[model samples]
Target: MNDFDIKMIKKLILKGQWLLSEHALDKLLERNLRIVDVLTSILNGEILEDYPDDPRGHSCLILGKKDNKYIHTVCGFQNKSLVIITSYIPELPKWIDERTRGGKYHE
Candidate 1:
């Protein structure tokens, strides 16, 4: 495992060098989340966990705030671009809280 620089990630996001994964898009749509929300969450967010060797690619879980609520955004760096792998509200058995993991299903 390795760490991704939050500054670098922020830069990538700011430059529009980012895109959503198919699954991320679906989740965003299903949850009624907009791209702006993701961007805001990332730009103003912090890295909660890093998945430097994610099979999908090198990605990390970010915890960010959007309108006073917390949202999780998983971003991956691939081909010099940031790929939003997935995102969701931190809740239930999967998450103990906004910044803590609880269950076995993490990602």
Candidate 2:
């Protein structure tokens, strides 16, 4: 993957405030070292994927982007994180943006 993609992936892994799958985490590990670097930076949190929008669960894939602002990923050795994207709340997606519209409360 390119630097930008790696960066975005890192942002998600470092900032995503949701639950991340161990399987996806494995895929992320295979991505690139730079991606691992970004993940190492935080040392906290993990990647989070689909939720309300994904009723069937199959619709849930890697990480769906609402506006392509920010993606999502997993972190932590145990893989513990939230389902809400905390890194780029305002500029990530409409769902996240609307959920965190107050910039204080989360949806």
Candidate 3:
């Protein structure tokens, strides 16, 4: 992913949108966004193509690193895809938790 993609990803994150397909998401980001972090954790290694099955369903995980900050990108299922961003895994971003309650999309 390039700088442009990063910006798009960040935009989507703020807007509470999750890309259903990783490839599609990448294409969208590549065209309009920029990388905010030079060495992001999300781009560190191979992105998990598949997610595990759960109550909330499976989701691919991507990590973004900015300075010492880490953003967790949880890309959920196709039918009901989700993105939960957090500086830390144990504690989710306050907004994310509030929005994700009851498994409903944030408004």
Candidate 4:
């Protein structure tokens, strides 16, 4: 993501200007994740991937850690509102680390 996009996301986060989609909420519950986990992840996470051409507009994948677990959060923007598309913990054979994937990397 660009600096502008990151800035916008950070602003929304700081102002509590984001919301989770039903699907995202369901996933969170299924994974035993809490709202605070999402928020904390957003506040301190690192953007690992960017999707500027997403059909839903600009979005990015963030890598965060909570309770010693790596949480991957997919976030997008809708009408200037930060939308939580999905969130889950990274598993083996897919992720090498919280910030690095197992396959080839993309810039």
On TM-score, the leading prediction is 1
As a whole number from 0 to 100, the lDDT of residue 56 in candidate 4 is 75
Better of 1 and 4 by TM-score: 1
TM-scores of the models, in the order given: 0.88, 0.24, 0.31, 0.81
Q: How close is candidate 1 to the true structure, as a TM-score?
A: 0.88
Cand. 3 TM to true fold: 0.31
Expressed as tens digits, the lDDT of each residue in 2-106 for candidate 1 is 358888889988898888889999999998888898899889999888776667667788999989889999887667888888889989898889977787866
Candidate with top lDDT is: 1
Candidate 4 — worst ten consecutive residues by lDDT sum? 1-10
**Ranking 1 against 2 by TM-score, winner:** 1
* lDDT-sorted candidate list, best first: 1, 4, 3, 2
Query: Candidate 2: lDDT over CA atoms?
Result: 0.34
Q: Which stretches of candidate 4 lie over 4 Å from their true place?
A: 1-4, 103-107
Q: Write the per-residue lDDT of candidate 2 for residues 30-102, one digit (tens) a residue.
A: 6432343333433332224333343322221133333322333322222333221112222433444422333
- Backbone clash total for model 1 is 0
Cα lDDT computed for each candidate against the true fold: 0.85, 0.34, 0.40, 0.79
Provide the global lDDT of candidate 4 against the true structure.
Answer: 0.79
> In candidate 4, how many Å is residue 90 off?
1.3
Clashing pairs in 2: 17-82, 18-81, 18-82, 18-83, 19-82, 46-75, 47-73, 47-74
lDDT of 3 by residue, 12-78 (tens): 5456554434553463365432333411444442242345654555445455554555444555434
